[model samples]
Target: MRDLVRKYKDFLAVKGVTFDVPEGEIFGFLGPNGAGKSTTIQILATLLKPTEGTAVVNGFDIRNEPDKVRQSIGLVFQDPSLDERLTARENLYFHAMLYNVETTIMKKRMAEVLEMVELADRQKDQVKTFSGGMRRRLEIARGLVHYPKVLFLDEPTVGLDPQTRKRIWEYIHYLRDKEGLTIFLTTHYMDEAENCQRIAVIDHGEIVALDTPENLKSVIGGDVIKISTDNNEEVLPVIKNRLQVKAEKQGDYIAIQVEKGEIFIPRLAVELKGRINSMVIKKPSLDDVFLHLTGREIREEGVNAVDRMRVYSKRKH
Candidate 1:
């Protein structure tokens, strides 16, 4: 996508965002709620049009050839889109028909996807009778019935248990490795974003940082030392002057990024002596990267009012 922008009346849900996903790679958009992840995905999937700029999906321009773009991609929305009254096989069959899959190959395709998601045995079960994990697996199977070049998974593992989420990721990796599918996913879960080959850290309708997980975490440089003291204001400057390193107050702690935290901790403990009330040391992680860039932790939150308005307007129109 090149300079893609989505405006909901006066509110810009998506700023002038730009990025690319390489073929067969698991590229992810990582951000908290209200950060425009869904709005961008909607634009890419042709469910919503951008206010400015455009994108090409599978070699077809989204603006000029929406039908072709739609044909070339599969989208599993953040919310459930499956028919609870229908059996799993029936849902996949409906999707196959909508994509105009050949009659001769439709059954074979449906069977293949069912097996891929390990839902072949339960294919005859009503979606409402299926567990949350099973329903999500069936949704993934339906998305793959047409075998599009790219798959967009919007919070594909949200609301599921840890074990179920792990299972879902297994199928995603299998699709990329065996089916050679390019996966574009949006997630707020830091651990989930780690599964991506590269991630775009978005905030407030803008891409704050984009890189591989390791690269993004490396921006924090080294181990993180979070020191909690009775008097942070008094200790922050002392640590900065004594260690000759930057120390910033994060929440109730003074956070310092340095190499060899294990080595530094001993010296720091000696330098501060009784001044330190508590201290914690750890390696850099995606959470740290987010905090470093955005000044806040990524937590579950409601969608932006503007994003909600955009969706409501789309439905009304």
Candidate 2:
């Protein structure tokens, strides 16, 4: 989207964000609650209009050619959109009809997608009888009924068990690799974002950082050394002056970033001696990158409807 902006009267939900996704690449939008990730996705999916700017999805203008844009893209929403009473095959068949797929090819397409999601055998069972993961897989199968070029997965794995989430990603990867489908997704899960080819970190209606996970973490320097000490007041300045490093005091601990944490630990051990209470060193993470850029943690918990309305209300006036 170029110069995209969404305003609810006065509240700015998305601020002139611009980015591109190449065909067949898995692109991710990563952020926390109230961060406008969903708002941006809505614009791209033709579900909402942008106050300013334009986007071209599969060569169709999102504003003037919304129908064409809708035709070329498939959307899997955060909430369950499946018909609980319908069998999986019936649901897929209904979607195929709604999308105007040729009747001759509908059965073939249903079989292909069902087999892709590995739900062909259970296609006769009601959706309510399937597990959460199975339901999600069927939803994805439904999205593929018309063979969309680009798929938008909004928080696709929310509320599922870890194993289920992993299985969902395996299917996602299979789609991109085997079917050559371009995938764009929004997620709050850090580990989930790592699976994407690249990610844009959004917060408070803006893109603060965008890059691959490795490159984003590299921007924070090297390994992270977190120290818990009883004498932070005494040790903070000593470490800074002697080591020429900056240390951030975070509540009960001092967080220091260095090129080589393991190598530096011996020096710290000898210099501080008995003064050190506890310390641990490890590699930087996407969470560290978010913290480095935003100075706050991207909330892992999903926001409720009331909280969403409250954010909207705050933005309006």
Each candidate's clash count: 0, 1
- Residue-level lDDT of model 2, residues 212-275, one tens digit each, is 9989988998888989877898888888889877676655777787898878888888888878
Runs of candidate 1 with Cα error greater than 4 angstroms are: 227-255, 270-279, 300-317
Clashing pairs for model 2 are 11-315
Provide the lDDT at 172 for model 2.
86
Worst 10 residues of 1 by lDDT: 305-314
Error of 2 at 202 (Å): 0.8
C-alpha lDDT (0 to 100) for residue 103 of candidate 2: 92
**Highest lDDT among the candidates is held by which one?**
1
